[model samples]
Target: MTILVTGATGTVGRHVVRHLLDHGRRVRALTRHPARAALPAGVEVAEGDLTSAAGLEAAFDGVTAAHLITFGGDYRPLDNGPRIVELAERAGVRRVTVLGGWREGTLEPALRASRLEWTFLQPVQFMANALTDWAGPLRATGRVREPYGDRKSPPIDEHDIGAVAATVLTRDGHAGRSYHLTGPEVLTARAMVAILAEATGRDLRFDELTPDQVRREWVAEGRRPDLSLFRAFSEVDGAGQADLVEMLLRLYGTPNELATTVTGDVERVTGRPPRTFAQWAADHAHHFQP
Candidate 1:
């Protein structure tokens, strides 16, 4: 099966390509710049734009299934989902796995309304998102300044997200399912910091930040958070640094059963347990070194 993996160079998408390759599936990695894709040797790097239907149509050729992101460049919403679906149907593509949600944009609705097989991979939060803030600071000073150090969450590994997507894309019985995936354990921010410190053999500290302080930090970063997108604790302007941190604080600190809960969805689908945050820390220890 020729599976077209969109956002193929992204954190999760790259792993999706890798997992598919491990399963011995033919993979076509979609990117705007094929020359710079740098995917595995066996994967086909196809130049395509998710926003442009004309560009997307060509990539759908001979593709049996697809792994697509809910949004496009700059985390922008893809409004041309129907057209993309049309092209896919025309090309006889059967199954698709979306890495986001239906409420985010028209893509999910379009996919659901289509005759094609669709599965939604909704992860609570990515463990890799920590590298965004902690990596640079740890690399420079072995410290992190963030809010809600006491806030707990079960952040799923990016690799697990990709693995689940690969399973849904290649195998049967996953269609029409919206999986709310998570790690095996719930961890507080301070606990995660301790793990990282232990993994890298360096002393690390988590300095709590007030929400106002984080908002101010966002201003200093020259990329402010868009309050309109705050429903998901998402920011449109930034890499969602402030928004996501605030979200973690809120989700874990409060009595919100949804975010702080752990589930076996990953293992249930992939037939293997989800990796823990400690394992994630060990794997990313290099980023925390002084």
Candidate 2:
């Protein structure tokens, strides 16, 4: 079966394409720049952008199943989400897997309203955040300073997220299911930092900051950021300084309340237990070192 993959170069999409190719599935990758898509040798790379509805016709052609994303260019929601699904429906695409972030967009509703088989993959947190939020700081100063160091979440591995998507895309019995994927256990930022210390053999530590301190730092770092407060920061972009600080306030703003819970979805879908945070740190320990 020919599977059309959008966001083929993204964190999860890269793993999805790799898993699909390893399984011998024919892949048609859609990216704005096919010349730089840099997919596997056997994969078919085509120039297509999902941000606009104009050039997706050839991407969906002759594809039985497909993978899609909720947003378009930036972190904003897709304006052409409905049109993309409509085109996929007309192209005889039977099954589809949608990779979504914290919030739902027009795409989910459009897919639900359609007759095609659809499954939504929602991952709470990515273990890769250590690299973005802490890795640089750790490498630079061996220190991680932030608010809400006690915030707890079950961060899933990007590979596991992709594997779950691969399972639902290539197999049956998962349609109409909204899976909340996470790692094997929940961990607080403090615990995660301790694990990093062990994995990297460094004297890394977490320093708790107040909300005011974090907000000031975020503003000072950026030229002019539109800072908004929320009960919870749910977007998956941990690198976003504004969102990170706000999320920290919401997380540490309260006491002993987990923003995300643990789930067995990964094991249920892939028949393997999700990887642990320590494993993630160990796997990426080389990156932590100078």
Question: Each prediction's TM-score against the native?
Answer: 0.88, 0.89
Give candidate 1's TM-score.
Answer: 0.88
lDDT tens digits, residue span 52-164, model 2: 87778888989999999987646556767789889999999999999985567789899999988999998876898777667777888887777778788888899998898
> Residue by residue across 36-55, what tens digits does model 1's lDDT show?
87888999888888988767
lDDT of 1 at 155: 89
- Model 2 gets an lDDT of 0.81
RMSD of each: 3.7, 3.9
Cα lDDT for residue 158, candidate 1:
95
Regions of candidate 1 where Cα sits further than 4 Å from its true position: 101-103, 215-255
For every model shown, the clashing-pair count is 0, 0
Q: Give the range where candidate 1 is weakest over 10 consecutive residues by summed lDDT.
A: 226-235
Q: What's the lDDT for residue 63 in model 1?
A: 96
